[model samples]
Target: MRRIRRMLVPAFAMALVFPAVLPAQAAPIRATVKSIEFEGMAAPASVKEMADQYSTASLKVTYSDGSVKTFPLSYNRLFKTTDSIGGTVAGVAIDHKGAPIIDNSVPANPTPYVSDSPDSNSLFQVPGMAPSALGGNALSLVTHYEYITFDNANQSAYGLIPASMSLTTLDQNKQTGELKPTELNKIDFSGVNGLWIPCNGSLSPWNTHLGSEEYDPDARAYEADPKATFISPFVQAYYQDKTKTGNPYDYGYIVEVKANADKSTQVAKHYSMGRFSHELTKIAPDGKTALFGDDGGNTMLFLYVADKAQDLSSGTLYAAKWVQKSAANGGSADLQWIKLGHGTDAELKVLVDKGLRFSDIFETSDKAAEGFTAIKTYPSGKIEYLKVKPGMEKAAAFLESRRYGAMLGATSEFNKMEGVTINEKDRKAYVAMSYVEKAMEKDAKGADPADDIQVDKISSGVTYELDLAGGAKDRDGSAIDSAYVPTFMSGLVVGEDLAKADALGNKAAVDKVANPDNLSYSESLRTLFIGEDSGMHVNNYLWAYNVDTHKLSRIMSVPAGAEATGLQFVEDLNGFSYIMSNFQHPGDELLLPDPLKIEVLAEINKSFENRKAGGVGYISGLPSMKQIVEAAPVIGDDNPTDKSLVDLRAKAAAAGAKLEWHGKNKDIVVTLGKHSLTTRVDSSTATIDGKKVNLPAATQFSKGKTYFSAAIWDQFIKL
Candidate 1:
């Protein structure tokens, strides 16, 4: 669904007011912005502007003094100020020079601190810190705890069934209304493969999540094709089986997990989709054909799986073929399906043994060329794994002597391919890529070719939209749609005009591309959201492109530390809109021989006959929040310290607390443990600096512990 951005509301002379029919508010909750306090600086001037753009109403922020400031609220989740009292903030604001700003202010431990201004460059210096504002304390760094949610019948384990519920609301706490928390439904999804990276992925037409594994697999020679050495990294399988290496190559392949299960043992693999680094998947509006992108650094290709569900076993996979030299050229490509017709099991075994590396021949030809390059080899790129093997003690030695060109392998036509989407209304497939500046070296100037690629190189994420006409046909020896193609083969086409137009489109696209990182279509919101990857130290952001406006603007950044990865628009039990992040949780596990497997036939048989008689045989998009919330008790503080409350209140104050840097080094430290105050319960009286002050129960305390650091300053007392 396309999410309507507030900006698209053309400044109407009159505002339309519908009846106050907010989806039934199950709770008596209200968000009131009490007051605003500034530390080093006053509220940003843009705060008011932001409120006007996204907030439901102008925020009335009263200061300790008699002054007041007003501003608009951000409609986007990344920008929305809600229930959370303390969390890292990362996102692009109109104010921060279009760079992501990270605010790590927590009220419980208020210590005003200032650090270096990070851009795209210094972000990755700290492993977990690169994505979020906090240098080391990122959310993805936390362990993936097994959490359960409530279902209509009872509690069910996650990954046991594809959750098919519409989300009603997303509170500030980050919990959705329908998917409830419970204990009985605990299930381990990390069978063997490990915790899947939370790249907010897409639900395919066939009900499978297009999740991408983020780990670089232990190198192995899975495909022994002497003809090919490199392979796209995506593969199909539940990450249950552990190997000396890891779950197959990072190459792209579709893995299906069936839902509507009666018993376990439902997961299965459909090896038809070709291998490549996959970002996301989208099917034609008709739901028969599928399109995906190869997000590898080398020349990547766009893949098509025709009739994927029923007969992808022998269908075509095509790469876009752009015309080389045509002024009238629109950068479009004739779909060229790879020519590896269904091979014998022996040939398939040979292809697999040759190492999943794509054929070097295909790489050499299309890597450097623009539109409609002929595919004489398997994958049109270089195979870099020919020299490296998992157990080879001499693998490093073999790599050192190899020619750089040979080692570097063939280049495909694109840079870093990322997101994929289909404009079914227009019958077009859109492939997106992150544009890397070719001129920049790893170091700023000449430190070292191998130094970490510097922070800034000018990145603009772009998308390519293709038209699949003539039944995926193109001239110039490019393969058109055909069933007798290899899983990774590009479809061949036969129209000179198609090739020329496709090439022209590819070139033109480079100029028009924007820096938007991730893309997804919201069936409910009826909009497309583009997310930014954490580039350099810049915080990744979320941007929404209004189909009506045709202009994209910064919506919000994902919370600090979690680089926006996969995006799927999900409806909650309350029918609210939510975008899930396929976060790469650190402690996620990979177990062997996953035990929760469901038998697909067993489950389907029970539902099939009833479903045939109009039972619908499916899970509802809406969930029962009452049952979920009931199962989940109001969690009390886990800390033994009643001081937890003290810390919470103190931290809340600190969040609004502001202090300027005072140290000569611009590095100052503030300690909370150093200060001790006494407070009464009823007509509370607190002594600060030996002075007595009356405090109300409502008065937020400023004491927690006694520890502060060189980086913090003073805390604001929110009396």
Candidate 2:
């Protein structure tokens, strides 16, 4: 056998000489296409053919001796440029089709991912990039890094930047005294802009993404005039099409992106969704009706048509009236849907009778709808049996009032809603809150101490499913579809759970029902994950919610020193799922060094004296636990007298409080009776009003139970 095998090897090697021995190969590349290069930017095109996946236009490989092989661009992966072939083509930005076009100036601003400047203050220094590099001030914090403002003094709403250029950062957490490993990357989304900042959005069945522009009065206008003034969130788009500035009256609406298309294409706003701080919207799988949450502090949950619907001028817009015990105990509430109408139809009757406003109710409907004819716009006439109850007449009337006074309190109840999504397959809607916590600090004795106050530590992220059918009932005692003002749909939920307290402040029951925050769902996993506030090491985590068992399980915990803020699933080119999260810096636990090493550190000082680990305490109003470690002050002897606390103290003073330093370097502890806050600070000399003060005020104060200190970074107060 061995001798035969040795003979066969040479025979097999020689057989390759035969022409038939070779298998058919890919057709040879033929055309000598000249490379087209953009001086400042890379071409938007990518190689589409399998053979050109890795080959670049820079390579001069001889493909089957020039068979006129033309390299084309196709979709490959998320956050990557297309492969280069033997020769590059001018990355032609096209319309919906693959044709080359001349002018490609849609929302033409250069993406924010590229640093506007390369200063030390630039986001690139943070080590972890932000969510959107283009985001302005407040948006810059979360956009640049995963940061949680435990103290509420710095809270304000901001705009969303495009996804392409996400700014990331590395931050030193104050609570855990840990250096969070910050790894950052930038993504250049082609043809994308005006991302709805960290708001709840929906994914369309067509694989596109839809979100609402939570534009305020400054960024948008909503007056009654047809030619109203408007501002473009995109600087480039704003400058080029000054004429198209939406009339203040024309702004609020849902915008849709064909995710599969080039990011540069101008997204169309479905004006049919109406003008308002259009918060969260979920399109039905059929793509007709849209369910929305109006988050201008407190407004009604609105439902609208998607332009394709017949009704444009008029359609049913329902205000949800939660029918529960206080209408405020969160989930105990139900919803009541009421339709809105333009009352002056009576005058239209007069016009039909004596001829005043118009000849008929539908007469000027055409004229009223003729305004926005850009995308086949038309107004739907008043449909009968739309059913506005006689009792809800006043409420529904005010909702439709163009009068500012009438609508003041009409919708101010729904405030600060953060997330919204729809399980299209289940016909359910979900909404959550980006909880706000405020800390208030003040001097305990004289002006010697600093103003260190924190308040509103409430964590809010709850998911409520909506029922499409209005809650009204039919004649046979069956629940009526009209009664369905989208109520909390029964299946999904998310967020932190508060620990129930008894009268004695002892642990009562687990406050499971009240505190589920930051909910995200995966249809593929058949799991709904909630971001919960885990005490000590991990401030918050992603917990899985079982729809069948109604139990919460820890799927994967957040790394130490990092709290999972934004949970988004981006489908990469390979069809794999990657989760995007904001890791707040100076995280609770120690952060491992760069190469992706992570460990959740337990609190080393968990002694009986530092408050026993029984249950979490309340920060602001939300439930939270004392973090194991304290964040070290970023200030030092060299950078002493830094304006770090100057603005903080000023802001607190304006809000009715004053601050002063308590300690010098040792962990400064602020004790308020039994409650205490501790952190590390650096030594510094201060000259206030030409008065030079040595070290922190803590050096002067004797031990006292009632006195608190603001030394270094952490503020501590007497219990």
Candidate 3:
């Protein structure tokens, strides 16, 4: 079934009214500006090395005054070996001591974050500038959380493996959004016990990088068997100390990294935000309210509202209870938040430094014992018997949050809750469900707690839309501090599973998304972009869905067995448009032990090229931002269409200027209204009455009339 939507007007132009009907085509093959439309390159062939193929995109923008301008952009992949066509190239790995893993004679060190590992989240900085700004460009810092670290040193649990996070300085051509790498440095993570699979990330409201550590080794599982170094190779490699188990509590929190003016970084692990497979965190406009998605089966959703603005060091954490309202199509539910004990990062870090154990915070049993809470399935689909010990609730909330929330009755019914992004203009948020099976569906094995999310299994997965609102009171009747509180969630896009596999061994529909991962939204464009991390598709795709039009367009696709990630949009970067994305683990085997995996691997081998380094890239355009602001007055609009014989008075208003004409002909008196008498307009020169000025353009007229010429106006704005 097709979903219909209304025009999501941008905040900048609330007064502008759109037509009653928008374009009906889901996605077109052409680009048009009158109405927003962009049909990117054709999808790659099934068994092709599609990574080498490039695409072109066009974006037509409509301004507050109803002026229209179109921007054309080029899309391509980036590697250490490749020079950036538009922006900075990524894919370099560094050690804790800040040395490149592999030598780079080339500008971009091709050593992937961890050799042969996937490069995860990418953040491209573009700060808004003032109108009167002059000279110089603002250096944009491109940051990436290298997913994992490995080299010749170690590939197994017993070997030494420490990951890295890199920050690259890219001086931008604001007018074009083109970038040139200036300096590259690694953000040291030794202070935080090192990052574990630093996965997805989001830009904080105050312009910092908010990232996560995903799929941390189970803390309780480690407690049961201390010798199981295979369970946590990261701990064994990073810590290596027989005396220290390497605190599991330290490895799964929101890690914040800030790059300073000197290319130095400030790194902090926000332990107050709860520990789990934190896929990512998105901060609302208020800055205090943060929504974090846990990536695993039977997971929980968490919300953290900071005690103060722009500070994640301390916050009040809340877990979600899925109050199912429907059973069909991945299930619709009203979210009820459970208040969990809060702690500051400073306090939580102390407990972690003391090497707190799972037994210290919670008591467990195979079956329900006296004072023990009922057994609840963990996010990994394993049933866990948990009972938060008295005086340890605060510790459990930060150390073993998913278990603590489940003990408190917050529903752990979600599966593969991956990525999240908010559309403040629409007061809505989007979440990616990589898979929609397991605990979310009916249980075959008998269980104690009831299944709140009993629904059909979806191998391809579902993407949910959550409604955000203000003035939402909590379960305890106290007002939630966040204005952007999520109230309900429903499947906005559901992927269909086919009984028969496709020609390329794809189990899901090609048109619809399979295993949607990173989600990013552009408020100005009213578009939600999605990336895929799927085993169902032989080749994963990147998509752009117009919220106002409800048209989902397959914009680009990656090579076979690759995970498309970090789909972010910059609607206006100094009047230029940018849509950035990156893919990783190309040519890897499709996840499984099935015969179909063998067949798919054989087909992928035909066009796939294996690389020792991870893949990191983006799609972009470049114009001089410094040039745009300087030319605003003379150009009027970004793409000015002033007539050949434009009237002097009419041209001034179009140039965003306010000027009054008192006299006409050779006796013309032009005043800025503030000046009693400034200058008089002549046939080709300005005569100073009170102020002296120069008129560069001579008078020209169409149909025997005299006015200013439109030619050469591209570089001037008469202030």
TM-score of 1: 0.42
| Per-prediction TM-score to the true structure, in the order listed | 0.42, 0.39, 0.75
Which runs in model 1 stand beyond 4 Å of their true positions? 1-179, 183-200, 214-252, 261-265, 306-314, 324-411, 439-458, 474-514, 523-526, 560-562, 571-576, 581-719
Write model 3 residue lDDT over 1-719, tens digit each, in one string: 00001011222222222232334331211111124444555556533344332445554444332345444556654444223323422343444444444422244534433433434444445345321122335454444534432333334211134555667655555454555555555678877777776678887878788878777567777787855433354554445433545656768778888766555778999989888888889999998999987877668888888999999999888988888888677778898888887789999889988988888888778876788776464533566667777899889888778878888888887878888999997799999888888778877665647577777788788889999999987777777888899999998877888898876667898888888888888765567888888888777887777777776777667766666766666555545555566665555555423565555455544433333334555666422222222222222223334334356566556755455555544344434322221233334433322222234554554554447645323222322
**Best candidate (score: TM-score):** 3
In order, the Cα lDDT scores of the candidates are 0.29, 0.30, 0.63
TM-score of 3: 0.75
Model 1 per-residue lDDT tens digits across residues 381-450: 3323232334331212111111111233222444455566654543444455555433112335542212
Q: Candidate 3: lDDT over CA atoms?
A: 0.63
Indicate the residue-level lDDT of 599 in model 2.
21
